[model samples]
Target chain A: MTFALLARCGRTGRIGLAIASEDLCTGAVFAHALRSNTGGSVTLGGSPGRNNTLACNLLAQGYAPARVLQELRANDPQCESRQIAVIDRHGRVAAHTGEALTRSALHRIEPGFAVLAGAAVKPSLVEALVQSFTASAALELDERLLKALESAAAECATPPRSVGIVAFGNQDYSDVDLRVDLHGDAIRELRRTYDEYQPFAAYYLERGKHPRQAIPQREFADMLYAGRSGNTR
Target chain B: MTYSIVARCPRTGRFGVGTATFSIACGRRNESVRANVGISKSQAFYDRATDPLVLNLLAQGYTPQYALGVLEAQDPDFQYRQLGIIDRAGTIGVHTGRDIGPWAGHAIGPQCVAFGNGLAGPQVVEGILGGFMAEPDAALEDRLLRAIEGGRDAGGQASNGQPRPERSAWLCVVDRGEHPLLDLRVDLHDRAVSQLRRVFEACDRGHLRVDTR
Candidate 1:
């Protein structure tokens, strides 16, 4: 089982998700699709399929959060065993946890946030996500998402084998996207990976949009430098 | 930048080193193993000459300490290099340069010496030592992996307060051919340990490349 959050920052027009599980390479299975700054979807658990497009269309049709859930519930026959959550560009949040969920399964929905867990997680993790996300106002979206995962894991007193973070900022691409395939300490690994990717995030974004003028001439000289294989003295 | 353990099984005669670092391709930079002779981890502001020098000294049938001492005597800035080694006979030695980074030290155990520099705390070395000392009967590869895991858990190398996952991790074992039975490396990965483990698991199965040379 797994736990995840699909969120949109009202102030920044960004959307993202933070997820963790006992699985390997969670990104491959869980990340349905993202529509740049429009929204993102997390499709997971119990024979899940790509429902993110459904969510996007529902949002575009101007359905409220409750109506979005009701529409999705009526459309899919296998919806009972699935867990899906979403945040539209306008920051409306909604989620669905199947009635078949075990007692441990839990989920929460706020105005601009949704935290949902599969059968393997306790309800307390949802609380941890909310509290940590609220407390981490000063951090970047990626770091805030990570803090939420750390908080949930800490409260549960057991970390997952794999953790993934995916965020969409002003650009159509993810500003910070990473995965800890498996580790004894996935949170620390995730944090390290995020830090490494952070320095290159904006450079790559600018490079994508304005390939010629994006990077400084001096810095780009160093950037294009290739390192040799072994120590040379 | 890192710490490591180079050891012999004493039973199977297999030799190996388990190491982690903030630097890239640490195995290629710091560790050198001469088949049936010995293994060494020379690191932290690493000097390129150390790997060959250690291998040459071991080839000449020198003890770990005398060999390192002779190597240090030839180098003017010997105080900056950190090293730990074990010979075929299981003779062990460790050296930390006086001018090396803070939290640098070594802990000697039977058949192995675990040492680290720029570590988070003293426990980093202790954990490597304790893990190696425990389960003495396990395969050398398993034991080495365990030691590195312990080292990370206790606090692996870092200039800051809490130790973070390293940028690279390496594990290598040599058979009688002096060729690596397994030489798996996570040269620069966020989940270095985990990636190395996956590579190790694949190499451990009959899925290994036997160096022909």
Candidate 2:
């Protein structure tokens, strides 16, 4: 019912997550959190409970992504329906999906990146997600992570019901968090919403720094997507 | 960063708010309910000050509309904020600032108001409102959850629409008690909406139930 990617930008040190599901409110139930100068984790699939949060805490404590995932899998009673991915501050990544959950449950790993998807998803879609992420080196971390979701969701036989992406940097605050909760095209909506919010992302940071001031809001010309338009070929 | 709805159940006199956001633990800051008084939410560049002020105004016996107006008048950043209020009497008020994100808007329904910013289009407001209205007889928490689910369905641009998960979701509902009768949250999870439902189902129904080994 779902797939998610948890990764950190080696260049910017920002943590990013992109997720999509036919299920409702995947963002709320799934795992997410990153400590600044520490690490992050994402829990998805069948049994996403407190263990997901435990994974994140372990990552924050300086556990290697693989070791944290290992400890979680061994401790959890129901590993068959769960998917988890962890990334350390150093950008090392690890992922696990319960094999019993789906015939097609799979993952793709690359340096500084990991893609985890459930059994219902085709391997091709999972590959598309990672390939898209790996190919988008020139784009910002948010754009890259989002395009990967767009690519993966595009391959579904029926367009996914929902999709979302959240990215946070050196601070615990989000640089961008866009969710197309109930859209015909969640990724497409995310693109539009992200485009709109991108210009003002810096303003929120400033607002935090100066809580008393009525910060000025300005409009900037939309940032153009270069080679990657997020359209399915 | 946030969008939410706070409403009262007519038959039961219970209060609840459904909220979801891109930020972590927005529930702790965005929601306030005085048992049977009222509820209000501030999002799209949320502030720590708004919910508390709305709660204080409600405590002073301010109507939802008047309370929202006063809060808006006092805040210089009101233009960038989206707020919705519903008192225990079911009086409803909502404000969407000019400088709030594009597609920023709200739909005021009878006994409730749904609002948000950073949406794919104005349809998101319509979606939340319609979702809330669809299940008129369900529990307030379920109704709010479904309503926001409608927002997810309302998300995405034109064609090739994809449903997006609510990044973080929370609900607080009260029965005849002064404290939150059912307080549940899914914080910044990949499947926050689902987790929210799971926890609520376990916690609701006149008793407390948590899965413990």
Candidate 3:
């Protein structure tokens, strides 16, 4: 299973995740993003529930980086089987990858950002994604995240037949937002979906997609969660 | 350059020619041949005047060997060029021009055949033939890949010295038991090919994998 996701929450935060696995329907297991006052975690190849709880708890306690990871390690039995990256509302970041990962897997943590990628990935992909963020001029954080995923996909000599990416951010209650998921030739399809929906830059964003009324969270969620084939666009 | 092609009409069991050389647009030339029943002389190959006409005569039920015999009776200098075909009933025929490139040849079989030119030697054709013969169950796409790979390994196009990284390549297979288009060209380099493939696959998935209702 391979998946790519991008989400933006008001101006408070941005998050991205890409995970590939030979297992069918792996997307339903890995790739979890949750953001609240405390912080958020972009967890891949790990327990979705435990990871989500730890992230929510850390944010609740105002914990950041190493402190949150240390607490997570203390509680989890198979810490090495998980790959987790977290960034809070304050731009603090931390990541961890268990030593039990296959030889083909690894993680990288840097200032204010981290990349946890593996499963038949070239070593250069991680570094390229991280470096491109600083050098590329993306209008939004989500854009940068998508570009990073594209770079990773293109770096492979023989790219895996499947690839995916995910990005999410916490938005203030008043800010406009969107969430997108896509698969297949990850970069091409992702860009296509972005252009077709024009979600981030939609004129309706400021108006909240309503001419004379404010769209409630439940209504927007209903619209966002409706799953239709990309062809429906 | 020399090349060959064979395909069966989906509605009728009629097999036809679908390959050409001289430039990259063999797809176009193959179309013209499809209207008629057999191989045609290269527009520029002057000496071989009525090769296509001969093949059409054979399509009327003459033996491939007899068909080539008739063409030989007309043009004694036929071996100087290259053309080949296998009709619907396992009938086979081939022609090689003396003026054609060195070491060009072909071998026909019940279901397929191998042909090539500008190769290291006749063994290149042999290698392609062997590859097709070895993989009986492979889809035509895979068989084409094996044949092309075999030709490449056997010194494809004699002048291809240093590996001139191919800008593009194509693979196609037409068999009677399935759709006329089994697997269309997958030009990994062309944005159009991948983009079109994505759209088609998405449509296919939408129709076959998901609940339309």
Candidate 1, residues B32-132: lDDT per residue as tens digits?
A: 76677888777654554566678778889888889888967877667766788888889987788887658788988888888888888789999998878
Identify the candidate with maximal lDDT. 1
Model 3 scores what on Cα lDDT? Answer: 0.46
Considering TM-score, which of the candidate structures 1 and 2 is the better prediction for this target?
2
Best by DockQ: 2
Model with the higher DockQ, candidate 1 or 3: 1
Instruction: Give the TM-score of chain A, superposed on the true chain A, for all candidates in the order listed.
Output: 0.82, 0.84, 0.69
Best by TM-score: 2
lDDT tens readout by residue for model 2, B1-213: 445677777777777788776544454432355565677777765564576678778878888778867876777677766788777788887888887546677777877877776667778778887888887977677788887777767772222132334556777676544435555555445566666666555432454222232
Off by more than 4 A, model 2? A30-32, A200-233, B1-16, B19-213
Worst 10 residues of 3 chain B by lDDT: B204-213
How do these models rank on DockQ, best leading? Answer: 2, 1, 3
Tell me the spans in candidate 3 whose CA falls farther than 4 Å from its real position.
A1-32, A157-183, A199-209, A212-233, B1-213
User: What docking grade does candidate 1 earn?
Assistant: incorrect
Give Cα-based local distance difference scores for all models: 0.69, 0.67, 0.46
The residue-by-residue lDDT of candidate 2 on A4-108, one tens digit each, is: 887888888887878887754455432235555677777775435456457667877778988998998888878767777788888898888776665677777
Q: lDDT (0-100) at residue A83 of candidate 2?
A: 78
Q: If the candidates were sorted by their lDDT against the true structure, best first, what order would they fall in?
A: 1, 2, 3
